[model samples]
Target: MNKALFLGLALSLLPIGCRTSNPSTTTSTGRITTGQRNQQAQPFAKGADIGWLPQMEASGYVFYNDQGVRQDCFQILKDHGINTIRLRTWVNPSSDSISGHCSKDETVAMAVRARKWGMRVMIDFHYSDSWADPGKQKKPAAWEGHDFPKLLTDVYEYTFEVMTALKAKGVTPEWVQVGNETPGGMIYPEGSTANWAQLAQLINKGYDAIKAVSPQSKVILHLDQGNNRERFRTWFDNARSHGAHYDVIGLSYYPYWLPGNPDYQLSIDDLARNMNELVERYGKEVMVVEVGGEDTKPQNTYDMLVAVQRRVKAVPNNKGLGVIYWEPEGARSWSKYPLSAWGNDGKPTKALDAFLAE
Candidate 1:
């Protein structure tokens, strides 16, 4: 799911002797060394992507509803050197209307809009009626009582429906996620167990759907709290044990949320270390699919993202694909108590200059 999730990655960064399917080789200094490196670190920004879709807009701004801002915003982002648009699809959002949450049609429209303006598109599937995140994983209304087999069938149908439509429209997705932040597992209890065989079936259903419809698209199995090396090791070990298939391993990194002492803040050094460990441990390609920081002056949160990126790029086995700000531009929370808070600009918040600067 787009809202539900979350990198250290490179394939070939491991030892030439002992081989894993997706190995990440490392140097003595701990900086990532790999033939599959995306780009070398430099002051200039390269190989990164940006976007502001309604579901995953780094800001979650409501300007999208206005139609005017929505149109202009797309152009504005493109004008600023942005080359991609990412949209999230919530399976059968409660209202069925594009205005209420996100839908397949709305995402296609957004993709059409972006394509018309020359930007590539990546569609995310949350497989739920509402948001899918580490904290809450809601099942879609249509798949209420479905068993694992039925659920997998629904996954294929729904995914095929969306991708098939996109292909016919000449706006096929450049990338598609099988499920959102599937840390606890996707489609709920059935495939939600720590069991890999069951979970792998769900993931494969999604992967198969994409390949059947959009063969060119890359599929991802995104996870959250990427900084925790052990958790990632455990998750991927389980996923592989279960036979899950995916092209990229997307991760969510929020330094503020990382566990530690009373402070628990992440320094640039910490970011580099954790991300580098990812490549050495998982070998799967990694992308910081979802990221965010608060909007205080000095761009406190934005600084963290910049630092994190810089550090990741500096890692010994760095592949440093890129990072995406998860709704950093969001307006306010969408819940009663207000939980839709990845990005908000109500207060005089700092702009995203920091992330852009470096």
Candidate 2:
């Protein structure tokens, strides 16, 4: 569900090994040397989609350490073991208080800040002026009335421009999500799943633009409901059949938001199964790119977070890249979002401690 909608309705990678200068280069304790570690691919990403951080700060939201001392939000997140920061960018967004202001400029600035804090970055392109999720993927206002041909150009140009801006700042995102929670598709009638062909073209354009700017960045096609295998299969099957290009299958798994507000236990195993199956079925890496729990239930949310991370790490052959907590720092007082990991006292909830575990 879109965050904006929730406020209105009710409120809602890598691998190791390969190519070492000297495979036998080991330290005195038999641990691999720094060179070997550097050569090896990145570890599982413990990410936080802090898209609302800027807005939160702008609105005078301050964070506190466990001891109640004032602290930088990034430092608080880092203290909780988050290694990657994910940001969402909206095109031509308004300056509205809650539902806007994720413009390209803001995204680039945030990416640079994350890099300064030694956190890798992931850029999510909503391609809309505001929120883009399972419920609504409205096209940017500037793109209104454009034909399919022009829409393709819009996606490519907008994506390329944003990627280029990030590159100019020397902050290449490790992963780039072309669309946000687009199970039904993005950009509206033209790019909707109702017409797979047009949707594929739009997606490919975004992919091409990202690669053009940062060839190393992995492109992700995201969808909601990580526990529903049928939904994933049906969507990805159409994506594959229509020649949509992406390197990763991104999923959102919010047990709290499920139809019945089911317990995480009811759906955790299914979420793991779906992730593994998606990797096998699509030959692409998988990631639980968006996840959250009820801020009010700190213990339950904590346990669920741990379980989610364990399932992601259990993916076969390390194809499971990681689990990211969406807006973990977006405290309820500021965002009125119930799924955040921050307590109303301005301190992080115990749920974020899950990232500290192996």
Best by lDDT: 2
Local accuracy of candidate 2 as per-residue lDDT tens digits, 160-275? 99999999999978889999999889999899999999999999999889877777677889999899999999999999898888877899999888888989999999999999
Candidate 2 residue spans exceeding 4 A from truth? 9-41
Query: Compared with the true structure, what per-residue lDDT tens digits does model 1 show for residues 1-358?
Result: 2332321122122111000012323232222345435544322222122222443332243433212334345554443344555667877764411124567786677678778987667778888876677766677888988777898899899999999888878887656788878878877777775666787887888888887776656677788777666667788778766667776677776654554511225444544566677666756556667665544323566566567667655655445556665543333332111111223333213334444456
When summed lDDT is taken over every stretch of 10 residues in candidate 2, the lowest stretch is: 13-22
Superposition TM-score, candidate 1 onto the true structure: 0.73
Weakest 10 consecutive residues of candidate 1 by summed lDDT = 12-21
Per-model TM-score on C-alpha atoms: 0.73, 0.91
For candidate 2, what is the lDDT? 0.83
RMSD of each: 10.8, 8.7
lDDT per prediction?
0.58, 0.83
